[model samples]
Target: MRSYGNKLFLFYIILTGSVLAVLGFVLGQLFPFYIVNYFSENNIDLDTDQIDYIKKQFAFIITFLLVVSFILICLINGKLIRNLLDPIENITQTARELTKGNYRSRAFAVGPANIVELRNSVNLLARNLQEIEKIREIENERLKTLIENMGSALIMIDREATVSIVNRQFLDGFQLDLDEVKDKNFLTLGLPKRIEEFIDHVFLTELPYRKQIEIEVNQEIQYKQIYGAPVVGEHGRWLGVVIVMHDISELIRLEQIRKDFVANVSHELRTPITSIKGFSETLLDGAFKDEKMLISFLDIIHQESNRLQMLIEDLLELSRLEQHGFSVKIMPTSLQEVLIRAVELTSPRLDEKNMQFNVDIARDVTVAGDFNRLIQIFTNLITNAITYSPENTTITLRIKKNDEYGIVEVEDEGMGIDKSEIARVFERFYRVDKARSRNSGGTGLGLAIVKHIIEAHYGKIQVNSTVGKGTCMIVYIPLRKKRN
Candidate 1:
């Protein structure tokens, strides 16, 4: 009871003061009465009735005076309490504001030493909160910037699945219309069932999730890897969920390309080598006994050997292009010479196909690059045109020069590349028509090698094709090396 009520400082002060004031009033009333009685005994003789009346009247007056003095004491006590309580009222108001998140609130310094100590403590607390708020603001900006530059898209939606926050990458990755997404529900806005299921699972289980889904959004199919984590607030309350979406299509494509390249490389080198091995073994056992037949087998073996040699040479050349210190010679050279040589190298191919070649060389069309590498670039393009085109379709090479660069384009009347396959044309072992590519003995390294060579000369290549209309491959090379 003492600690809860009596030991309370304000109550203790007010109570102690009231006790002292009452005692003083009682003594003051008694002392005067006692002095008046002493004077009456010494100075006057009174009859019994008169003496009784005087005593009664003195008792009444003392009683009335005591009442008046008590009232006065109470008034003074109240004024003193007001002096003690006014600082507390100010501190309470500030504390109320602090509880409302106004950490900058401060208390008045009018109270006693101990109460002043409390005020200082509160001020220090406010200062700390102000510092924390400043740090939080800076961190928020830094975090937002970090999220903007991150490759993955991040979005946070409340429990109702309304998007409350979306990082910059999230907006750009999906080409999202921000205004449309702000308050829309995933169900109403048309999200995939898999994504909805994932969100439901997260909410129900109160756990995180990760899954990859193939999304066909707006007629474009893409592989999206989604990871969702719970946003927990105070007391482990589930506030929202954060989703990070990553575009894994390129990585997936590269992995597939790597696997195919290994398989294709094995098939390409093994076929002719296997043929030579089989024929040589047969001849060694008994086929050589028939001499006339033996000569035909030897000729076939030589042809296979030459094919193996060619394959090995091309592989070595590609390796050289990839190695460090194997840079191109950037000097202005006649693109005509490079195109002519590329055509001459493919002459046997044209003759074998019995296909006519159309050459349109714009006068003074020039490029700056290594001559041999540039020749390889054009030759690969021309050879692909010849190999892929139908029997009677003509292959055309056109060169035109502008002020800055020369453009060499090869147009072939062939079964054009599928729109989906065009992006991966330069990737090794990517074939638009796999069956035709394999049957025609396309090594698949040709375009890959051409890509490296053209890039080495700081050139660009673009392909445009329609299904029935043949493909056009444009090569852009600088007329002079633009010095940096």
Candidate 2:
């Protein structure tokens, strides 16, 4: 490459040559005239040979000086040019490094004032660019993290309706691989028909769309709340769409439970209320005239009233246990003591049935729980066992403690629960055998209450049963250190 030094040297030589030519011309004219006049006045004459000799000497001296001056100028010009060009060269190198993604590269401050200024400006620009790049990287990472952990499925598409980005939630929830769907058109991606239609509408309208959609996945219906919006570019240009999918299946199920609870409560209240009203009416309509009939009717009314009271009390207790502010009175309580109290409360029924009791308990095992609530947990389980087991059947009660938990188990050799019905056993007012449960004086809320009590103490309850074999209920409550 032609350098600045060389170009400057060439220009200097040309200008110096022109100046020497003009000086030579002036000297030739003036010196000749002046010398001739002086020689004439002084009566001095010179031969042509001597004149030629003098002229040759003058030409040789001037040529030698010109060559030396040219050499000096070349040296000066090179240094000057280098001083000017070095900063520019460094700046260029820094630019190259920046283009290569090395933002840390910088130019040294050197050369003239102007060159230094230029270098500073270039460095400032690079610093600003670096800052911008850092900001962009941080924002990108934050966006990625939010999308992955949002617990909602999301997809992004390009203007061509090609799937360009899908987050981890979307991939896992839908069981898809990025390689299978990325860069492929939406219609060919095997998405649900409803989702495809949603995308199409959002793309066409370039507006936000929201809807609730149901799709069967693996033969199970899933409810989703989907939101679709157009991705707009600069100047409001259409840039495909983004779809956000939220699984609202749990919300839907809860709403159905609420409705069912209302219906079931109404049905339960109606039966008892009907009985109480009918029996009271019979008594008032002259059944009181006959002593035997009056006594029988009064007894019927009193029994119905008692059942209603029991149902109401159970419902109230359940409501209290389920309240959001339901906090148990937690303290160090003995598991053995709680079990003894529950057994004492259920002893009358045990004796009447002549059911054999098998107790295996470890003494002084302590757990953190509400004392009264723990008693209620075991009492409900024992009473449930008593009602289900036949006379003379053996009922087992076991208590033990591990490093983490105090475990209590109550098992009965009664007709075991159906496997399919086991999952719903703890539901409020849920009865596996409705007629038998009512006849045996069950409010159908007993197990539900027991579940809440155990959970309040951060414990777990599990049931194992076979159709012909007996049902076994096992409970675990977090163990605590013995009180001092």
Candidate 3:
């Protein structure tokens, strides 16, 4: 039951006692006899007074020797105990530091061989712990960076339905900050109720879930695909659920456009096809006997057939333009020549509408594009201006060059487009006045084709219009250097 300190003190006391006892026993047996023998051997005769003085001197000598021996033992034991305990004290301090998470601490390898070995082992353990801690920290940082930059919105909720983690993508996508979401409830973040329901279901069932969801943000409908999975810990313990969302708004929009295109094409073809079939059947049913009626019906049939052909050609051209492999033949060509050719082609409409052409083109201005596509672009613009403008109104074709591009503007004092519909003018099958466009022999794909052609040349086209004032279509094409 004695502590180490008490045991050490007791050992020191016992060793001192044993040394004194042994010295006392030897001195008791031999000291007096040696003194008598020395005096007898030397033949030195003494009186009673001389013997008494000698005995007193012997007692004094034994006492002084015992005192010196005790002092030496005490000094030596103190030095030995200090040497034994100092290294052990250093090792204990290091252990305490390690327990406090200071893995860099190390004990000094001093003292006896065995103690030195223990110190070295402790130091080795500390170094290993430090290395392991460093690696773990690096891995944790890498995981954090990966989650933040994963490009898909991600949210994690614990079993308590508390939002635990939201990455950078989730914050940016939802227009939220860390303070708004961290440690918040899953149902209270202004998220669609369906998302909250899905999270609750995941937590209750401890299973994965996936669905396509529609959400409205800023009054615009958006489609998203969500993937949810349960996060489980050791021994299948439910930890949390992780949800990832991918935006599919563009895909949904494209699908809608495709459906609309199919329906419009069908309707456009059906009208012409019905007219041609009816006229042909009538001609075979003795309507040919009346020459005047026969000629009128045949002409109508021919016009309808031509309109159908034009619609099909426009659709095919648009499909080609949108194909992945579609490419333009880019070569330096004269912008002036292209404009002149387009003007000549549209002169028939100009003559019919009695419109005046005001042409102003820069001399020798060149552009990089396919010649036929450039001609098509200008032809469509001029024809549209002629079709929409009142007779005798001037249509202006001004071509010029700036620092980096050749610019062309086809302007008209026509019944202009509305501001709200201006943005959608280049969309296929979009017409400002559908009935008027049909009667004027106009295909609604003209501006759409013009846009595709301009985009192929890496150029831009824009429209500016004020109702009842005028409309101006501006095209900017990259200028090409003249070859010597």
> Deviation in angstroms for 81 in model 2?
8.8
Please provide, for model 2 over 256-283, each residue's C-alpha lDDT reduced to its tens digit, 9 standing for 90 to 100: 7688778878888888889889988887
C-alpha TM-scores of all predictions: 0.66, 0.66, 0.59
After TM-score superposition, what is the CA distance of residue 205 in candidate 2 from its true location, in Å?
8.2
Error of 1 at 236 (Å): 2.9
Give the TM-score (vs. native) of candidate 1: 0.66
TM-score of 3: 0.59
Error of 3 at 186 (Å): 5.1
Give the distance in Å from residue 293's predicted Cα in candidate 1 to where it truly belongs: 2.6
Pairs clashing in candidate 3?
A: none
The per-model lDDT (C-alpha) reads: 0.80, 0.85, 0.87
Which residue runs does candidate 2 get wrong by more than 4 Å? 1-90, 141-208, 215-222, 235-240, 247-254, 286-296, 322-324, 347-365, 385-425, 460-476, 481-484
Query: Candidate 2: lDDT of 166?
Result: 86
Q: Write the per-residue lDDT of candidate 1 for residues 97-147, one digit (tens) a residue.
A: 888989878987586898899888888888898899889999999998887
Which parts of model 1 are misplaced by more than 4 Å? 1-134, 187-193, 216-222, 289-292, 324-326, 359-368, 400-406, 432-441, 478-484
